[model samples]
Target chain A: MFRAGEVDALIHLGVMHDPRARPAEIYSWNITGTTKLLEYCQAYRVPKVVLLSSANVYGPRPDNPQFLTEDAPLLAAQRFPQMRDLVEIDHLVSTFLWRAQGVETVILRPVHIVGPVHNAPSNYLRIPRPPVLLGFDPMVQLIHYQDTADAIVAALAPGRRGIYNIVGPGEVPLSAVLRELGREPVQIPHPVARPILSLAFRLGISSFPVAELDFIRYVCMVDGRRAGAELGFRPRFGLRETIHAVDEPA
Target chain B: MHTAGVGLLDRLHKLRGQVPDDDIAGRTQALVVRGNEFAMRVARWLYRNYFRASAFGIEHVPATGRVLFVANHAGQLPFDALVICAACFLEPPTPRLVRSMVEYFVPTVPFASYLFARWGQITGTPENCRRLLAAEEAVLVFPEGARGISKSFARRYQLGEFGTGFMRLALEMRAPIVPIAVIGAEEQAPAVNIKPLARLLGAPSFPVVPYPPFVPLVPLPVKYRLYFGEPMTMTGDPDDDDDVLDEKARIVKSRIQSMIHVGLREREHVFW
Candidate 1:
């Protein structure tokens, strides 16, 4: 597959991003399928590789700082199995980079990437009456989808290989973001929010899984400094610009 | 009377100037959190008319430097914190926005969380504290946590066991610890007993104030006197033994307690 186009670097932007996908289906595409692809890359001897990971790997823990570094432990997967697979996939890729004979790998973990196609947070925010956990105004960082592509391209530029958090310059409170979107949130107690979200998803009303709702409940921000300095990748859209992209109508 | 009204409004416009205008700055993070301007204005009004708050030893708060204000948390909610911040912002000897280290459970609520973030309130995490200190910003901490605020009416004036994290953080960040004693806050909405009803709401505490029994959340009118002590410096490994950390915490606790005693002695009346 790799020798066909004289491809010097292979970037894996394909991952089961939507948590609403059935567990088995998501595992097949994100976990097992990703492995099969990486194995092929090794067999085909692809010189360089880059994997798109989510900053959600950090998890929405009470202790998580507003800005997190790449070194932070990947705990998001523990809370939501959906995230668990991404961390597992990251673990696999990281291990491969160290042991693989010739592949130079880079992992990019970006916060909510907004664009024409709706992502988790964007999809959640679009609900006419979005449900927010009572109390948490966890700040949300946005990166333009194009910016993510730019980061992947920057990683393809060669040099160092490892993990980099591709993030934007500023963050707006999740509450303010909702206000900016002109959406009224139904405040639900945290304990009840999970079950309600689960039921809503079961009814096919919710676009994403219940576990991903933690993003709206706690702070899980990532520091994008390394991406800018090491990969020469910077986000083009400012805070309001990226948010407005999500607010765009269908 | 018309001239007096205009003068007051003009003075208020000047007070609004102290609140960082984040829109023009294009900065996010803390600066972007201009807080609820209306809420702040109300807080300002209360800082003057309600509490009639006054500050002493303001010079101790450095003109520009990373500082941690370790104050007694009381008055059911955080009246002490509001009045202290108000005292700092309103008076100009050392005017600086003081970021309050909010309890971990604080951000779990809706509008309140939004207001706190707008007011530059960060979760009481060591990482957040370190970042603020590194940036040379002032942070207000209630090391007593719920223990101090939830204390029964009898123990209102007493400083509870201080959390060792602040001391360890102070040691780690090398940020000077400024002990603060907020008088009269203990008298406002004094919680006689804190019921475990917070579990129902998934909240941290649900203190039971004796007055107005139905509305325990409302605080009574009380005068405030905020005393800022000399900057206390510490030296030692932040990762020192538990006993060492506890001992360090005790020194600051004692300092605040002594200051509180003086504040209590000086205040002629609670409703002054």
Candidate 2:
């Protein structure tokens, strides 16, 4: 599909298809596969490209501040191997598209993308505990799935290039989100939760990789000002509305 | 101490019995004496003032006997090693003074080598390594070697490929490897700019080189924190092959890298 000359822009989705594979394997598929596709784009002289990268690239930042900007360094030491791989793939795609090929590449590091069709298991929702609250002080930045899709469409428009961190209208605590869903969650200290998570990985009951644990302590809070200012993006839903956007009907 | 105050010629003759004429120790001692006066003055000043460097996890450093102090290399500066030497040798109740064997190029410069030799620093040769370890003396080696110092500024904290010689020596001598992380060395010179032309002319980089600001200026007030991780003992079989030795070296290197990262994360600021 990427090689077809008729396609002006190649949007490489299907990256999160397999969550069970080791983080390295999943990353190889995203990063290596994207490299090959980018090579094809260069050979074909494709003028524009948009890659779907995760906001998890920001990793965990403090919840008190509750906003992560694009300028934040990508934290690669987190416990989730997949998240780390996604972060690496984002760098690879951005570097190849912007630096190597000189073709316009727009990267979207969206936070906790959610929507009605988002049946795929996500860290934000599938967390083992009910309330899913971060320890004592936790901050979370999220984006509605519809808004994420719209941002993609906006980037696909003519003559748009650069990186953007997309998030919903506001930030919320994991516990707050869980409360909105009417489920009380157990608040476990990261130190305590980390070992349990590691045991899960060992027992093959959970897919969380060791690297992903780095964020459980630091909550990534990014600024969405650029996405709104430059891309003319205005999230249509707030945290409460977006939480319910994906909540299954009773 | 008063038993032997021999002339230079007499000392040269006396050394023949203990060290062969072709051996490098004679030359090393001569170099040490050449710079002995200046090194003492500097060492005294460093000890009296600005020697406030404190170490965490000092227990990680072996209390006695043979040990390997493996650490990260930050550019061409020897300040980091000097600080380590001062802390270990000059501090109160010094626990088993150490000798750091550095690269051959370090002793190439007349003044630099003299001070280095006077302070018990030696060339990092295989023979010197075996001799030092055999004496059960603590030895310091930057396994990353020259590449670690020569790497571009952008690669800071990302360790370069480590040479396996240190690990081999440790295994051969059955010594414990103590990983040390020295924060703030990178900020001392900062390497803000590199001058390739000056380098070809045998001159140091133009601005912000790794050495002290001026060839004569003392180090500025940048705070340094050295963290030592628990010693990792080589448990590999004595008859392990080269591949095994290389793997052991990598494991040691990774542990050092982790200690460095942890130290950096714990620090509030490197420049303070």
Candidate 3:
């Protein structure tokens, strides 16, 4: 519905992450659909475009530094092949950001967005007894879904182009977040958790892929100083509020 | 939709419990305070009765501001780190934390993963060190890294080849480097490293002490003497040549080496 000189900004937030959806379907919607949308934006002379990317593009790595900057490589797809779609979409938008002469592309990679949302982190927290890998409690960063929305709105400001890691209240250990939510996590050994999760996924009992277990095992936090400096964005939520947002009713 | 979210936040803010208004670092420090208190009690017990550790030149550690405590690393385990941490907590003008750079593999371990971070220990990364230093916090580094820790018993008190990372960070952040000489840790677990075995086991080093329980799990109770040298400040390009960085690093290394010699001469026995 884009008419030339009419649409001021095109905020692209459409990306598929349905665990049940086929990879082919996900690729079509996330890649092909985004390509068409970017093409349309370019043809229609949209001045600004904000893409909602994720800090998971860096991947939950055991060797990751406490805080990853924006310049860090997007290597999420190295281990988990399923993450290729999101990584590809990020690469596509970033390429478009540099190539598109007129369109101002802003890529915001926020950390795990919690709150009254049906995302992986929030949904995992919602579980009364989430499965935690035994002996591995990595520090995790979370942004309230509202805070994430605020970051997008901040990016919509004119001249705020380039990538930014939108952090929230702050980081805490996985156990601390679980304690705040009053979750009694079932500790599973890392070696056996994979086969069990894989079988459970095959049996249609669990939606979490075996590859996704690394989220609870390794750290993938990011530094948000750039966002704070450039976009003038900061989360209004406290750490306790951010962690408790998962339990808030939708 | 935006209004609803804001309203919900405002409502939650009103009904807030005793949630501490602090960022991650502050929250982690709060946890560290609690954890440090308990750890200090135990560490003090070990320092006084068990190891009989004596900390000298404690006044060199500044009561405030960011400082880099560069020390010698030894003991099959990190009792040296513990003793250094305990020394800072116990003997400083005001009890302060000496945040040590833990190994990357620590995150994979169970209790140690989060406990180390809670107690203000961080993974050994330039970014982590730079951030902590900028925040005006003290950080501890062992430039010898694994090589110094897993050295054979024959090489006790001999300084390993120091890496130049900490020197660059020290110069970049403008934080003074406090050279620490931890004597006794080198002799705590006098084990020989079997490189082939370490490779087969996919471990850092395979150390086997001469005594029973050859793994060096429980260190022999040796007296720990920590000498804190005067804080040294170097000014130069942090991204300078490796040779330039190494030259500065050698200065710190030699300082620690000389302190270690003095400490060795002063001690009458290992288990005093």
Highest DockQ model number? 1
Those runs of model 2 whose alpha carbons end farther than 4 Å from true positions after fitting are A1-4, A16-19, A22-24, A61-66, A77-80, A100-102, A117-135, A210-216, B1-272
Better of 2 and 3 by lDDT: 3
Task: Name the 10 consecutive residues with the lowest summed lDDT in model 1 chain B.
Answer: B1-10
Model 1, range B1-272, lDDT digits (tens) per residue?
Answer: 11333333344444335444354124333244233445567778989888888888887878788999999988778888889887776665435678888887766566665567667777787888999999998999999997787677788788888879999989999999999999988888766653557777666667775555644567788888989999999999999999999999999999999999999999899999
TM-score of each: 0.86, 0.44, 0.90
Quote the B-chain TM-score, candidate 1: 0.86
- Pick out the ten consecutive residues of candidate 3 chain B with the lowest summed lDDT: B1-10
lDDT string, candidate 2, B1-272, tens digits: 11234333333233223433332334333444444434544653553455446677775666567888998876456667777765554332333456877676543343443345445676686556777777778888888876665555567788888877888788778888888888766555555445685487564433354564433234554566777788888876645787887888888788878878888888886555
Candidate 3 has an lDDT of 0.87
lDDT of 2 at A171: 58
Q: Can you list each candidate's DockQ? A: 0.49, 0.01, 0.39
Worst 10 residues of 1 chain A by lDDT: A1-10
B170-229: candidate 3 lDDT, tens digit per residue: 999999999999999988998999999989876788999999988999999999999999
Please, what are the lDDT tens digits per residue for candidate 1 over residues A50-143? 9998888889876677688898889987788777778888888888888885888999898888876666766776777888777666778878
lDDT of 2 at B208: 53
